[model samples]
Target: MSNKDEAITIVSNFLEASMAPDPELAATYMAADVRITFTGGRAMASPQAITDFNSGRYAWVKKALGPFDWTEHEDHTVVYSNGTLYGEWPDGRPFAGNRYLDRFEVRNGRITRMDVWNDSAEWLLTPELNQES
Candidate 1:
């Protein structure tokens, strides 16, 4: 596998681990300094922080990541990823089909920074997403 391919594999495995409900497994892919910026200016700078934020939201978080479709510019590899994460809230209200697009910058095969956008608006607007609020 080329560098990007390897990165994609790692990214895919990361998502798989999340669905495994193993925070330790899921965390291996993240650099200690990994930085993730969600829309609405919500940023998570630590593996623990990101895990904590997502872990509580649903019973299972599953994603299918592929096609990579990337460009390398200077020191940054701009990659576009489309995938869906499925899970449910703590209340036993099931929510699946949460889709997302993520842009990532990888340095030395380590993800340094990321920007993510998702159709979670659908999740949020749904009666399921609203129940939490």
Candidate 2:
């Protein structure tokens, strides 16, 4: 497989492990010095930190994964994963169609950086927008 394909697979596997809430497994796909930035510019040092943050913000969550778009650079591959998030919130409110976009930098078969953005904050600010009308 090409480096691009491998990067995609690595990212896909990591996402699966993450949704499984298996931080140890997820960590396997990331570099030891991985940099992760979530919504609100929260910096995370490791996969376990991500799980902890999620646990606080969501009762349970999973991604409705979309296509993986990538660009290969001289030393690393930049991959973008765009999709909607579906899950229950901390308040036990089930929500769907919360769009999310994640950017990852994969180098030498491991993800070195990740940035995440999502619409959950907007939904939270105006919960009536998430209510079934």
Report the lDDT of model 2 for residue 98: 88
**Model 1 Cα shift for residue 18 (angstroms):** 3.6
lDDT of 1: 0.67
Tell me the whole-model lDDT of each prediction, alpha carbons only: 0.67, 0.94
RMSD of each: 3.7, 1.2
lDDT of 1 by residue, 1-133 (tens): 6667766766666656655657677677767788889756689765556667776655545566646677767775666778766566667666555677877766676677778777655665566554333
lDDT of 2 at 70: 98
lDDT of 2 by residue, 16-63 (tens): 999999999999999999999999999999999999999998999999
lDDT of 2: 0.94
Off-target runs (Cα >4 Å) in candidate 2 are 131-133
**TM-score (all chains, Cα) for each model:** 0.74, 0.96
- Evaluated at residue 114, the lDDT of candidate 1 is 71
What TM-score would you give candidate 2 relative to the actual structure?
A: 0.96
